[model samples]
Target: MFWFLLIAMVVVIAAVTLAVVGGGESDVLPEAAPQHLTDPLPLTRPVARADIEELRLPVAARGYRMGDVDDVLGRLGAELAERDARIAHLEAALAGAQATAADRPGAPGMFDEPPADRPGDLPDGSGERGEDR
Candidate 1:
């Protein structure tokens, strides 16, 4: 029984070795991502918000010129945040306007123009005092 087990183990090892050796050249091996792939900035590519946020610059003898990179990243982050806030504000305004229009009794439809006759008209084309101009 011991001899049989030893023979089986040897056969398994031989099979594994043969399979690995028979596999085609290094080309068949899984290729690793290039070193630069992890860096946020790649030459000739446009930088994005996430790329700026997650950037990892290489350091040399004097180390990285971090002040410049930090300033740029901070400015970019702030700008991106401000733009997001503006988008949210606009979206909220749009939603509120839509809701107000929907609640009106006679809201104007697409291509419908407000009455130019009214001095100060509401969105529903009602005059300021709900009377005809």
Candidate 2:
């Protein structure tokens, strides 16, 4: 049985070697003379100036008037004033919060207390008390 398998493997390898060496099938195209081709129609035409000048423009009228530069500048100044007021309000709020935090007890020295030895050091009775009894 082993010898039969070895012979079958040798036959398969020989067939594969023959197929590779023989360059299995032809994929090359036959040689032919190249042909020249030409375009069938004209690609472009010249535009008439009268046709262009007589064309009616279809633009919609703007709702807001953009007439004077000073008017635009005035609107921008009003918007900036509103933004400045908002910034001032936020700064006041931040200052109030900082003041309140500073006035609160244990604000600066929050971590000044010594670290507890175990989790149950503070008196809520979960069995890690230091006193013997």
Candidate 3:
């Protein structure tokens, strides 16, 4: 009756506990180390848009390591500055070349005068309409 059911339940609980806790034998699962970021940014080549998008910073005890964030920011800043300087230099060189070309005798300029007569027009000043006209 009730006593028989209670005894059966107790035996089942005790068996499960022993099986899980395992009388002090070595467990099947061994201790594992936490995952960490090994190689974040590429050293040989420049960082591309894809690299930035795919970057996953390693998490620290608090949130993220500050050193990694600072390093990435510094590198991106340096690259932008260098690109800006190069752009300015190229723009100056282009302006100088355009000026020299314009000063030459037969170089076409943007401010050239328009022709007095228009094409497809007759002496009467009427333009070509179509075959019907």
For every candidate in turn, the CA RMSD to the true structure comes to 13.5, 28.3, 6.6
Q: Where in model 1 is the C-alpha error above 4 Å?
A: 1-63, 109-133
- In terms of lDDT, the best-performing candidate is 3
Q: What C-alpha lDDT do the candidate models reach, one value each?
A: 0.67, 0.57, 0.79
How many clashing residue pairs appear in each of the predictions shown?
0, 0, 0
**Per-residue lDDT for 62-91 in model 2, tens only?**
433343334434644665687799999999
Q: After superposition, how far is residue 48 of candidate 2 from its true place, in Å?
A: 43
Off by over 4 Å in 3: 1-36, 109-117, 120-133
lDDT of candidate 2 vs native?
0.57
Q: What TM-score number comes out for model 3?
A: 0.55
TM-score of each: 0.36, 0.31, 0.55
lDDT by residue (1-133, candidate 3, tens digit) is 9999999999999999988887665665775665466667777887888988988887877888788888888888887898899999999988888788689887676555765655456565667545537
**Clashes by residue pair, model 3:** none
The local distance difference test score of model 1 is: 0.67
lDDT of 1 by residue, 4-85 (tens): 9999999999999988788678648676643322454534644576766687765544766575567657766776787899
